[model samples]
Target chain A: MNNNTSIIVTSEKLNLQTCYDFVKDPSCGGIALFVGTVRNHSYQKEVTLLNFSSYSSMAVKEMTKIAEQAIASFDIYKIAIHHATGDLQIGDIPVIIAVSSAHRGAAFKACEYAIDTLKETVPIWKKEHFIDGQVWVNTHP
Target chain B: MKIKVLFFGIFTDIFGKTTIELEVPSPINVVELKAFIIKNNPKSTALHFAVALGETYADDNARIHEQQVVALIPPVSGG
Candidate 1:
């Protein structure tokens, strides 16, 4: 684990300011952050809420791996990743990725890679509760 | 050998419980363990799933040992 990397999976609401604080470094010249929020609709359905579940142990492990990869792949000073579980309403933040680097290019690229890789590998699932019914998103074909 | 199986995401919905303990023969691989799970809980076969041994993702040929933490992982949708 990198000393500057922070990996968190929780049920509480995410705080963006904390993420910014975590990645703040005097030596870094630029910071990039990505915030993923619950959307109002999915597949043309009116989504009312989302309930998230995760294999906590593996989720953290995979998240750490992504952070480590980002640290090694990019010229970044620090990285922080936080994800939320349980029920969340539309417009609520579910995930946040922060990266700090000596240049804007590295910060931006590393931030994008972190979020993209996290979506593909992390063991977290979201079930959208529509007005009429609810279904786990992306579970089946 | 007794193995502990943990369910997550849609798998928990299919299994109707979070954790299950099963007794299988010794030296079982991940493929065989998945087969045993599907045989006992047929609904689990409906979704494409992967297995994780401890903190790492396990391939189908990976061997399962006694008291290892095993988890069923469905397709991920996190952002």
Candidate 2:
């Protein structure tokens, strides 16, 4: 079912090299990668850390769907989407998306689509912890 | 019938646990189950949640069976 897509959701750290390698293909001439890090600030708050969590099985399924959609919509060769859960400190890598295609245009487009779709569909959530308190992202208005 | 309802993201924080086993007197649909949950814990009504049967999203009128795995998915924020 999952052909050239690598979809992972875990509490362990996300590895950029792994995703890059998975999407690397001999025929593909271009590779695009995206890495998401825990920012130090949000909404004028001095964020201390971030806590990420997910319904792992659903998240993986959703990510796989995104990868498949990117490949189908674009001329991509292979794709990988990986995300991390649990406590994340400032600058910690939380997510990574890599795409490879015969040309740079398709690679870049597919990479962007993968990340954007993941944010919308994957069952992962982030809690931003500030020096004062903590709040879940996208939870409230 | 009894089913285990899983909570993800902020639902975990609001519910104070990851999963809960709830009993339904009869075969319940997704909408009914959601109402049953909300009637018990009204605070959950504050945030919208999507229902999933196993790993797939379900319609409100979808019938839920005993011993099935259900999940209440809140808004996602992954990138």
Candidate 3:
């Protein structure tokens, strides 16, 4: 449950196993993970693909801040956050967040909070491609 | 000097590029660059955005580095 237990990656090539293992330690007990994949539909429209772009540095910083805040607020043992940038097809793992804590309650809370904070604060934007057309939503983050 | 300015989401369509460059004097900060951009493109004033500097979120107090990659991020709808 030290500094090495956390990672923040924004790469085209993602190593899910590596990220999972990074926070997988024989600590207290529970290890909760959240893998956000691109869904095939959004609001009933068929989604073809998703293009995720991030202000890499800022996104990383914001993610780190979330991790730090979670660690401080919750009893989490370790944390890992990895997000993919570039073109992503349906079912692609766009974001992965793992949290380890002594108990399941803290793990679940921290994991959910981490992803929610990332969406709210991280400097990353995604474009949705539908069958009819594509639209860029939200330009005020 | 010149720097790379990236726009995400709807801003891309408005600016027509994932990235652009702002011509400005040396040693400009985030606020100054935003002001410069607004002055050049008054239409952009209607939009609210956030600036990201090399792995860190930038605000009005953030400093601009020479040749640094800056991204203008708009609100996102993805869950």
Worst window of 10 by summed lDDT in candidate 2 chain A: A132-141
**DockQ winner among the candidates?**
1
How accurate locally is residue B64 in candidate 3, as Cα lDDT from 0 to 100? 88
Top model number, lDDT: 1
* lDDT: worst 10-residue window of model 3 chain B: B41-50
Evaluating just chain A, the predictions reach TM-scores of 0.96, 0.96, 0.91
Give RMSD to native, each candidate.
1.7, 1.9, 3.4
Stretches > 4 Å off in candidate 1 = A139-141
- Supply DockQ values for each candidate: 0.67, 0.63, 0.47
Q: Over the stretch B3-75, how does candidate 1's per-residue lDDT look in tens digits?
A: 8888888777788889988798888999998877777775635657788997788999999999877888888
Q: Model 1: clashing residue pairs?
A: none
Return the TM-score for each candidate structure.
0.94, 0.93, 0.79
Consecutive 10-residue window with the lowest summed lDDT within model 2 chain B:
B39-48
Error of 3 at A71 (Å): 1.5
Per-residue accuracy of model 3 over A49-136 as CA lDDT, tens digit each: 9888766666667778888899999998888888888888888988888888888999899999998888888777788899889877
